[model samples]
Target: MKKKIILIAVFVIAVAASVYLYAMYKPHRDITAETADFTVSVKQLQEEYAKNDTMFNKKYMDKTIEVKGVVSTIDDAENGIVIDEKLSVTFNDSTKKEIAVGKSIKIKGRLLTYDDILEEFKMDQASVIK
Candidate 1:
């Protein structure tokens, strides 16, 4: 009886550990290394921004997305990076370190959806390519 109980406990613990590790290391779905889809000009992005809708949100909301654009400006004061023309993206310190003004690069991360009075739809949480 004692051996059976101990075996059961070990099995349960092993299953729990496996579940935790899977959750921790699981690769996010919907991530793509797509560059052709994101090759629009800065002016085009600005036009979309003016329309209060972005292709970013249209295509990759609630999923991992990858895009390539020029780094127009870096607002350290605001902890954000402005890409294309008018896309204001905020990211953490590690992401910021990989971006620089005038550099053409790729960003891959989860796309968050937001609806506000100023902007109808927006995407956030983008990571930078090193």
Candidate 2:
């Protein structure tokens, strides 16, 4: 009788532990899926940069985000690539692999708040979606 009770208790504990772990590792729902990708023209992007640098700064500052645009240039040395659109951004090397000039792509990356030498927002570790 004692052995039976101990076995039951052990089984219960094991089940409880498994449930807790599964709950902790569950995938989170993606919020970006609901919002449509922002699309802007290259000329529009340049205008916005000139008109409201601060607002542009606030929109992209240090956030993990996705943007869709046309590839303009790729700089392997700096690991950077540029997207020509309403919000022109330079993505680092990792992003370059995912994009090429004249190709339209969706880039997900962390937007660096600091201004680059080119006066463009630096996008690091960008993942490009064809």
- Clash counts for the predictions, in order: 0, 3
TM-score between model 2 and native: 0.48
Q: What does candidate 1's lDDT look like per residue over 77-105, in tens digits?
A: 87777676445666644466667799887
Candidate 1 ranges beyond 4 A from true positions: 1-58, 113-121
Q: Give the candidate number with the greatest TM-score.
A: 2
10 residues in a row with least lDDT, candidate 1? 30-39
**Model 2 backbone overlap count:** 3
Give lDDT for model 1: 0.61
Q: TM-scores of the models, in the given order?
A: 0.47, 0.48
- Please give the range of 10 consecutive residues that has the lowest summed lDDT in model 2: 29-38
The C-alpha local distance difference test score for the whole of candidate 2 amounts to 0.62
Q: Deviation in angstroms for 33 in model 1? A: 14
